[model samples]
Target: MAALRPCTLLLPVAALLFFCAAGFAVRFPDPPGAWLLSLAAVAAIAAPPLAALLRLFGPARWLAALALLSAFAFAVESLGVATGWPYGRFYYGEGLGPLLGGLVPYLLPVSYVPLVVGAVAAARHPRSRPLWTLRSAALLTLIDGVLDPGAALLGFWVWPGGGPYYGVPASNYLGWLLSGAVSSAVLVLLWPRGSPAPPALLDGTLLALAFWTGVAAFGGLALPAALGVALLAAFLARRAGIRGCARVTFLKKN
Candidate 1:
């Protein structure tokens, strides 16, 4: 890990604490101030990932990626709100803060950019663009599988009649696939030339994953929580394996 300032480290730590508090709050029946807790949880969780990504990619490339992702997310969300195409028909309920032009939330990028960056980092296969994009898209969708159900149960948004897999429609996942793939492509196209810090310790993906799983478990969503936990374990194992290989290579070179 780089020499990140104590203040920088605090962002993710604060996010983790708020998420834990929100989980406990949501676990109760008709919990007081649940909306505020949930809102704080989301905002806090997104912070460290954004900061970490910016540092990894540097400001120039990071800014470009950020602009592209933010604009795309806003446009798509506005369209979704207006026409209900991707992500199914849904409306915000409470505690998402102010809307941009009364359409999408001003901080919509904060909710999305981290997941996109993290997935890209994890799935960046050097040889095959298609495979890299596919892995990125798949990882991003898997994260939503963990996130959406918990949010739905907490009434972050309403899905009307609901659908299979804990009231989130199958179509929503389909939408995520499409969106995730497209976003991955854009990110890949804009990938920075220099080598970034290794993905494992680069950012808040693991932290985000833990928070998502914990919230799901606290909200009584077993399957999604288990899946998230499983993914986190796999990622950690992969990272450890890479480190072991790197050490072997270093010893041979020396």
Candidate 2:
């Protein structure tokens, strides 16, 4: 972590940005392209983990393992979606349409990119383990399970064939274990560098985006899905120390 100053980290980040732009353009083309194009795109998604790994572990060790596993899982998932391979039993709805090699269809990882990044940052920060768990759980539930689906409904994105095979895509959430627990743990293990924290207007915006998009997205398939998410967020916030619960009780008293 000490070696990860902004100046030194600049080049890898620039490369990450470049690859993401190139990958997104090709992989998620307006009409999408052949499997080769999709493969390159899939490969590009590995950039963040790769970049972070380089910074964290620097030549070798645990971060490399996480980055490698993450890339492999992403590869399998992208290929599976493209060809309807191994876990091809499910389907997303028509609203999502056939996306770029089926990769663009789920659009789950976009939301999760920020989520896992934030989670890692938070966990690595000075905080109690239980508090981190509670915070992380609430964050994941809202960001991954709730907000992402909402965006899919608004034409922002869609899960055309995201059949909830036993609740959520086994691939997406499964990779999260690598990102949240394994990757975070690895970072902690290697370096304990702490820095002045940055503010989060963007984070707040993402949360709002998740909320609005979730409402818009889920309201399409089932209004109940939307309403239920709203209620759930309220409940979880209360659980996490948000203080609006008493308002309901006060209203009832009146």
Candidate 3:
């Protein structure tokens, strides 16, 4: 109990650090010290939800869940590399830790797993699993809109023959939709029944949303910023409505 307080306090601190690192990285072209800082920020962003998962689901289950997510993302990225069916023809840039088989980054899961978990945890659709899955997937896709443009501008990745959306190809979003749908569906179905998602998960999502939106706006990427703001508003409203409904049900039962 005593230890939890410091750990709990770390969440906001880490989140703030992430925003600073991310902002510096995106604002400057390969800023010195930004790559390592960005890597640390990724870990910081992932830590809160991960800690929550460990507490709620136990170590074994949490590890298993992470493994599943990592495998799925790696598989999809590998396929993208080989086939170029989804995400169009693009290749990674430097400073992203290490690569698996010299293909996808070893830390690819660092970028994906927590986002999926947070989106799944934040989604509210009590009666319809399909709706819940779809909502979470959409949220995932929308977030990429905010992130990919900044990354592209920062030279983190290159879309050779960039089509639209600030050098991001349309197919990239299509890939995200397909991958997001599958990942969210699997996580939602396998999530334990009657276990509420921790607030840290929501915090993680909100922090990502705000920082990305702010960065995009500052960098003059208007479309992604607008989309981020709009999606965030809708997401918050949907969650509020779901909570209201749940409260009504509880009251009626009482």
Best by lDDT: 3
| Preferred candidate (lDDT higher): 1 or 3 | 3
lDDT of 3: 0.71
- The local distance difference test score of model 1 is 0.70
Over 4 Å off in model 1, which ranges? 1-19, 28-43, 194-197, 200-202, 241-254
TM-score of 1: 0.80
Give, for candidate 1, the lowest lDDT window spanning 10 residues.
244-253
Candidate order (lDDT): 3, 1, 2
List, residue by residue over 96-175, the lDDT tens digit for candidate 2.
34444546444333323434443444333455544554454444444445444443433344345564621345555544
The better-scoring model by TM-score among 1 and 3 is 3
State residue 188's C-alpha deviation in candidate 2, in Å: 4.7
- Best-fitting candidate, scored by TM-score: 3
Cα-lDDT of candidate 2: 0.40
Residue range 1-254, candidate 1, lDDT tens digits: 43333333543465466457547646662456654654565565565556656655678988898899989999888887777879888876555656777767776787788778778877778777788899999988998998888777766667886889899899889888999998999888777554543433324566677776777888888999899888777665554444321221111232
Model 2 spans > 4 angstroms off: 1-112, 122-138, 151-179, 186-192, 201-208, 211-254
**How far in Å is the alpha carbon of 237 misplaced in model 1?**
2.7
Candidate 3: residue pairs that collide: none
Q: State residue 95's C-alpha deviation in candidate 2, in Å.
A: 11
